[model samples]
Target: AKVYYHDFVVQATKVKRLCTTHNTITVNGQFPGPTLEVNDGDTLVVNVVNKARYNVTIHWHGVRQVRSGWADGPEFVTQCPIRPGGSYTYRFTIQGQVGTLWWHAHSSWLRATVYGALVIRPKEGTSYPFPKPKRETPILLGEWWDANPIDVVREATRTGGAPNVSDAYTINGQPGDLYNCSSKDTVIVPIDSGETHLLRVINAALNQELFFTVANHRFTVVGADASYLKPFTTSVIMLGPGQTTDVLISGDQPPARYYMAAEPYQSAQGAPFDNTTTTAILEYKSAPCPAKGISSKPVMPTLPAFNDTATVTAFIQSFRSPNKVDVPTDIDENLFITVGLGLFNCPKNFGSSRCQGPNGTRFTASMNNVSFVLPSNVSILQAYKQGVPGVFTTDFPANPPVQFDYTGNVSRSLWQPVPGTKVYKLKYGSRVQIVLQGTNIQTAENHPIHIHGYDFYILATGFGNFNPQKDTAKFNLVDPPMRNTVGVSVNGWAVIRFVADNPGAWLMHCHLDVHITWGLAVVFLVENGVGELQSLQPPPADLPPC
Candidate 1:
């Protein structure tokens, strides 16, 4: 494979669309950023130059950093931000991964404007489990905030409450029809009567899990998070924040314009804050007898409700064995943890003393009571360079003291942080299992927990609390969806197992951009094997200095 080296300038550009205009930041001047096509095993050197006003860093989401943690970009977590006018080159090789992944800005709120799809095809002789499509199109779903994203966050931090909702949800950088008044509005897709199209859908929304569907077409979900799944067909699909689903649509139907729509899936507690759904028009080509006007009565297929707990549970179960691809079962290490929201006394400057949260108390989520705070002096990469053994605690609780109570009054609960949480220690090549329990406090928000490096098997998940006896009996030891991230359902807990074969400092944290910014993160250190990973060669001279 050829070595891929590229330079990108992250700058703000004024783009005019749908008769309105706004200044948005882009990489190399492209609104949707740039497409990076590479093959398995190929090395990539991406020099990112920050010309925009905000500090930034680009993270290769879902890629196992494996001794290259410096390139794992999560501001403060992995490395310091590349200051404005500064530059940083991310150097790493694609190893054992051949599918769709993505890259995005990892600094505060910058990712809202900066992101692109990273496509990795298999090496020369490798074949896909399903037949390859004639053409592939990336369909990225994002949230559009009319106000400056930085300002939105700043106001939220100052108000001590939920920030204002976004103006519209976007598809490939365009807000389809919903925000006609907004400058970033996009024209919807026009489909031919009998066309089959591949839609590589990515949910980059900061906090919501979306249910996606076209008016009448059936979608076959084939791949997710850079890995192909055992193909499955569904009318409507649910995608959590930070998750990706590749679907195939067969437009074999009457020619008529229909709306492609996405809405928040119901949470365990109740409907989303805003019940309005985002809509995109899908125009099917005219037939021999052209209709006079667009059909507003196109069939709206039955989709799961935003808070259909049963369906969500079943869908999650179906992703486990033997209905899915086989996963290696022998675990090398087992780590258990409890995740919950706790209250902290906000200093006088931030807000009022009495804040509303779970149980009426001000709340913040944590991994086993200890919210992992990013030290101002340490970068996630610098910590790895200094070694991971001492940077994180290894004593996280094996089991939680209290499971969530969906119907209980969380607002009145008194909460405190868990001290001395344990971190996991593993040798390279050790198989591992991690159980995460959720404590119900305030609201039951979905936690899309993402891990760097290796994909793991989701063993099981349950509500109320985890019953060790019953849950263990139902564990799927065979086929499971090999994913780098899994959603910890509201008021529920999940168990995941994987192999610690990749060496480096990896981060495991909530995919919710807001939660991660507030510090729901941890590091996984995989010790090096004899010698080093073959891909760990020195970077070339003249690399961009960021």
Candidate 2:
């Protein structure tokens, strides 16, 4: 209904955390950046000036950019990154989506510091599906590293090893009073007694899935990834790196300060992670104030163990659509894709300091046994539109190249994956079903798969393997949850279905940054329909160069 214009400056700033200072790249110099609030049916025009040292591109994490691929920024996927000292503009409109989404740097590890919230409310004449809350708050969960995040990834790339984990988890940008030198700036959420508040929680960590909760408070989940769901009450919820959750909470407890904290949800066995927690305080204004300069300690919540798979599975399976809708009753494309970690044997003459992993092999990841490699010469969408040859191939396998016991013991010979820039081609408006099966190549682990450009309904999830004969009967067609991301449990399977109505080159990949860097990704190219609007718009004049 309206147009929102903004200017973002990507520049370096001195940021202090955990008693150490580092020069970090940020958007407009804000730690978590500025929150951009817009209503449904509104257009956003953002002019981004890259004043930082490295190249930059901003991706609207969960926004459905309809036919506007030029504005859907994903480094080399849709467009090239804006180089240092250059500028670019992103323009798109919000069609029917309304809830919590976010924006972040899509290049390298810059998103660790350059990220913020993008909230979409209902259109002019529409309202929320559930009752309105007294007020709303955006709670962003992030990770804090003692060293520069870019350096961490650079060292990992140089050595062909996994990146180092962060020093502490974060609520917004602070490590909160639980850590040293953070009590003065701890984030405090003030609320009135007996009033309900809406909390939009986003997990922006680079490589971890987090479990978030508030002390002595249980919230009612209403939406996720911008889609409303059947209101369910839960004590805690889990979020992958690229996921968002919207919940309603009431201030029914005694008026005092209670801790809202987040910790790692580590389902992958033997994977290294940060064991520390981040927190904020929910301060009830109706309670008596604490003595000056001598405040009482906030009450902390009890969270599940780091490897609590049962609790995570139960919470994930509880999501359902608030209303009945037509699921893909008939399928057009059924794909059984195997995704997990693998190993790449180090070259005999390699002389890097960290070149060794397990048994003299470097770490790798894959889908269909193909490691995804991004093109540095041109963007995928650009090459597809200009009919350029040799940039990429549309022969990404429809199924795993070789299939065995997906969740059982895998041989060492089959642990190596080939790297390529490949995409799967599809017709517009085709119904699709993808069975995302987790494997035990290195170790059975939980992977949250995120698909860009479309939201799909989650039909069913089960452990071990997904058998069509037995599992197909368990699909929930009546009220399956629609979401942009789903966490396939460790050694488990999840089935999702969506219509290929958007014509563009879109990416489907694991949300963990480390896994993506190791080649756990694929792309889909949907052909255009017989209409102008069904086709992607021409490339913008200010599109960045490769």
Candidate 3:
């Protein structure tokens, strides 16, 4: 197959709707970015030019770069930031993936405006487990803040506490009607009567899981996180941050425009984040009428409350222990880590001991007591130069002796780089398992943890602590969704297992960009094996410079 190439300029654009004007960042001046369609074996070359004021880099989320780690995007990890007015070309081949993935900015806050859908069609003559829909649409969910997002983070870091919530949640960049006194708040999904539409939904929110539903309609979810699952029908679908779902909506019923909407699924007892942010609207257009008329407000559906624990638990269970296919068990490696929220005092000065926190509070989230520290430079490439050993630590905590210490004095200090750290080493085809425990120290914030290069199975999850005897009995050693990311419940714990079949250095981090910026990130060192996969070939000479 021939290689495909595209050039895009990221810039700001003005959009007018419902008598209101707003500014948005776009790729090549198009909102929701552009779509990239390719086959399984096709090569993709994208030249991303940063025309915006801030630095930027683009990541092919969920696409395993494999040995092409140079193309992996995570500023200061695989590559450096593309400075303002600078350009970088991401080159990689779409190897074994065939489903719905996405692309987004990797630099700080730039993703707020730079993102798009990446659709990989199956190889010739290949088909999915379920029937394909006649029409398909990508519904990218995002967060919107009228104030500058950078400023929001800046203030939070200075205050040493949680940042203020966003002004609204957006579906395809529109905060469908739900906000008060907002005239331009609406999401319009045009659909023909009696036809089915495939809605590809991506929850790109920084800090919240979402519950989505449409008025007077049930959807059959057939795919998730770029992988096809056996189709299942439901009235509402719950998706965590960084997760994606593909559902088919039947337009056979009364087809006047009906509002499709999404809202935060976090409970009131959790962190103090926004509760009533409406992300998008599904507008079902009816068959043509004789004359044009104003579209009456679609009847608003009764949405579930923000803190409905039963609904949340039931929704989560629906996606658990999937029944359709079985994954091979000749696994490769296993690992364990605990996730929790705490506080560490940042020195009043850069390297001084004298420190203070927000209202004298020092709060943060981490995996283990050791918060991940993102290197100032791309550590993977540096490791490759320095012999790949001694760059990362293999001493990650195996298990937390105290799993749920709500009153424990969790460390409130940031991750300061140790002068020397032992690097993690793993051979190809290693089966990996990571046990994540969430401790309720200072605040109980839910963390959506994500890993790069490969997806894993959620073996088990439980609340209020991990007991060796009692917890092991409830393990669902069945067909959990093979996911690249999973949520660590507030004041609870989760155990995920996978195979490190892809050979390359991979990143694992909190999906919340805010926590990621605060140093919640790590790298996996997949050592080269004997035979065909022993070593990786360097990138091409003309590889776009990021």
Candidate 4:
């Protein structure tokens, strides 16, 4: 009901972490950028000015753009990036979504530092479906590199190898007391006894899933991806990049400082990750201060091991809608897409330096054996709207080109994926179901697949390849969780359904930056509907040029 205007200036700033200083790109000079708070149904007009050296685009993650597809920024997906010294205005309204969502830079590697929370409360004069909390806080879990993150990704891109892992994990931009020279600046959340607080936890890490827990406290999860869920209590929560969880915590423990920490939930076997823990303190207002020249450490929580898949599975399975949802039963499009990593045999023309992956190969990923390639001359949306040709093809496969044991030992011959800018076409208002099957070509890892401009219901998920006959019966048509992002389990599959009512070029990809760089992505082009109301709005005048 209200319009909010903001100016986001992306610039370079000197930030020190892990006892080292690095020049970091940031928005408004904040490492975790800026938190945008609005009520449901409010309109946001963000003028993003690219003062940094890199081209950039800001995405309002989990905010269904509806008719405003041009503002759903994903670099070359919806619109071109705003070049350095250039500016672009993104205008879109948040519709019926209310809970925890976030905003981040959609361009290459800039989101490592240019990201923040987008908290949506109930509309004005309206209240939450559940009881009110005493206060609210945004816990942004992020990754930090001692070296420049852009440089890190750039080197990986040049070598065609996996990027270097982050030096440390972060909580609100600090590495916390666990690391050197961080105790003084560890983020502290103050609370009063017997008061309940809402914690909007967002995992903005570039390429890692995280497990979060507060010492001596259990969380009652109330919402995720800006949608309310049936409240469930859990000791820990796992979030893939671009995912969010809203949980309520009560200050019922004895008056003391308790550590709230986040660490990597590394699922890929033999893959390296930052094993460090980042922490914040939940301090009671009545707690006594430390004596002179003496410091007291907060009570640390026992976290799950990095490879704890059982806990992750249990936590994921617990999510359900607060009530029955209108899950589409009659599917107009049913896609069984295989998602996994591959190894491209090193090309002799490129030389050894360029092919630094396993056994001198290049790492790649695909959906249905086609690696996604972004167009350089024009964005997908622009090409589609302006009738531009040769930008992309509408021949993305509905299923794998060659079928085999998806979760079994795959042949080395199938490890290479062909690269193309392909998109799947969908009619307006068509009901769709997609079986995201994880394969074991190179190795299996959890993929946080995210879609722009739409939120879908997660009907069911299970380990191993998804079978229509056996797994279709496992679908939960009623009370299934609705989300904009779903973490396809390692060597597993997840079935999701949604109505293709939003007309636009929407990018669906793995949220892990490295995996997306390896081309685990696709686009869905939803055709315009009957009238103006159901069609995509016109592109803004200041839309960035390619």
> Number of the top candidate by TM-score?
4
Ranking by lDDT: 4, 2, 1, 3
Error of 2 at 510 (Å): 0.6
TM-score of each: 0.87, 0.97, 0.87, 0.98
Per residue, candidate 4 scores C-alpha lDDT tens digits across 208-252 of: 899999999999999999999999999999999999999999999
Model 2, span 1-546: residue lDDT tens = 999999999999999888888898988889999999999999999999999989899999888889987888888999999999999999999988989999999888888999999999999888998888999998999988888888988888777777888887889898887787777778888788999999999999888899999999998999999888999999999899989999999999998888898888874422222236688889888768842322977777888887888898889889999999889888898888888999887776876465656776778889888899999978999999998899898888888877788778888777688889989998999999999999877654578999989999999998988888999998999999998988887688999999998989898999888888888899899889878978888889999987
Which runs of model 3 end up more than 4 angstroms from their true locations? 14-24, 179-185, 267-284, 287-294, 320-333, 346-359, 385-394, 400-423, 531-534, 540-546
In terms of lDDT, model 3 sits at 0.68
Worst 10 residues of 4 by lDDT: 266-275
Q: What is the C-alpha lDDT of each candidate?
A: 0.69, 0.87, 0.68, 0.90
lDDT of 3 by residue, 1-546 (tens): 658999989877775432456676679987678989887888999998878777777888888786777788777667667777888788888876767788888777667768888887776577765666768888888777776676777777666667778767778876655555443546566677777888888887776777788878888887777776666788888777678888899887664656677877764433222335463445555534411332566656556776666776666566643474454455454445666555565555633222234445445555655666655555565555456564456765554333435324444332222222223556776777677766655544567788887777777776776666888676667767667777777677787777666666677887877777555666677766676655555654543343
Per-residue alpha-carbon lDDT of candidate 1 for residues 344-423, written as tens digits (9 for 90 to 100): 65555544634533333344557756667654545644555555455556554544444444324554343465433234
**Candidate 4 steric clashes:** 0
Candidate 3 at 148: error in angstroms?
Answer: 2.1
Error of 1 at 72 (Å): 1.5
Q: lDDT: which candidate is best?
A: 4
